[model samples]
Target: MTVKTRIYLVRHGETAWNAGGKFQGHSDIPLSERGRKQAKALAERLSNLKIDAFYSSDLSRARETAGILAEPHRGTVYYLPELREINFGRWEGLTFKEIAEAYGELSTRWWASPLTIQIPAGESLQQVVDRCTRAVAGIITRHAGETVVVAAHGGVIRVIVGAALGLDLNHFWQLRLDNVSLTVLEYHGPEKAILELFNDTCHLHEK
Candidate 1:
């Protein structure tokens, strides 16, 4: 009576804004040329696995990345808005320096205490954690004892990983989610999960 679920958590490939370190939260940015190649490489690496389902954030970059990976399996890709990146509000397209200059002390506070601070028209870390938790819970429930792949943004990945590991949102920075990197998590039923891998880029290195 042991149910095991294998989940492949992936961060979408690089985007134009990602290279520039600009905030792309909720932005429907497309993948860059290199990004597309990275996705293809990942697809090839994962093609042999028995992936039962594919899921991705509704954003274009994430969907495109997932599409490339799911092609070999002919897997059905589901888009969940809850998997989208946290909204950056007025800092949507700005870099850290730009945000610092514009909001000064408030920007510092936001970075230091994002769990409690809310950006203008943006979401708090807690809000993201809640949404991502619900989304992940639903996916795990629907695909119990199966293998699935999820392509999403870096922020979303962090929140999801943190929740799975029982880490605080403020400690999310400890997890590195490079573009096109693969992370694996195993769910052994409710409240039981294990991190098998994180930020794996072996496929990229092979290129």
Candidate 2:
């Protein structure tokens, strides 16, 4: 029987920026009080799972969320900087309307053609895919056949899932990753991967 490595991809809990609907790409903002409570609740929901390893983006929000989950299992948490959110360049911290007002048609084109268009002073969707793919590949290689949890941003989670499914980066928005949501992926061999779940927020019902 082929051993399958299970990966739990979790999006970090909400932050102040998330509540405000602002683009928080690459920002090091900490989680809001609600976010902290959500993480704790998620920890409780996952308490019974035997996690072999835990990993997270280096950003404060993701790191803290991972810490909360890891505390119960005492699992080793690894920080992967490459798992950080996509750089929004000059558009960082801007709301959707603000970006449209500032860049007009350019912003529309960016949303419509993210994979091909590069954000001025930031990364393109393809660039994000490359970085996230590298980080995921590295983790899978190191922990094959084990259950691992990776806490990261929504954007990063989208790209990682896309790459695993062999989908184009332009279709990244199709994957809806909510704050504190969990996605599960399984790797059966050197090249085969399966997405078992996406954007599961069942724990939020307890909140």
Task: Output the number of the lDDT-best candidate.
Answer: 1
Could you give me the TM-score of model 2 versus the true structure?
0.96
TM-score of each: 0.97, 0.96
lDDT of 2 by residue, 49-137 (tens): 99999999999999999999999998878999999999898988899999999999889898888988888788888888888888888
Model 2 worst lDDT run, 10 consecutive residues? 184-193
State model 2's lDDT.
0.90
- Predicted structure with the largest TM-score when compared to the true one: 1
Which segments of candidate 2 are over 4 A away from where they belong? none
Task: Give the alpha-carbon lDDT of every model.
Answer: 0.91, 0.90
lDDT of 1 by residue, 73-172 (tens): 9887999999999988888999989999999998988888888889988988899888888888899899999999999988888888788888878867
Clashing pairs in 1: none
Look at candidate 2 and tell me the lDDT of residue 55.
97
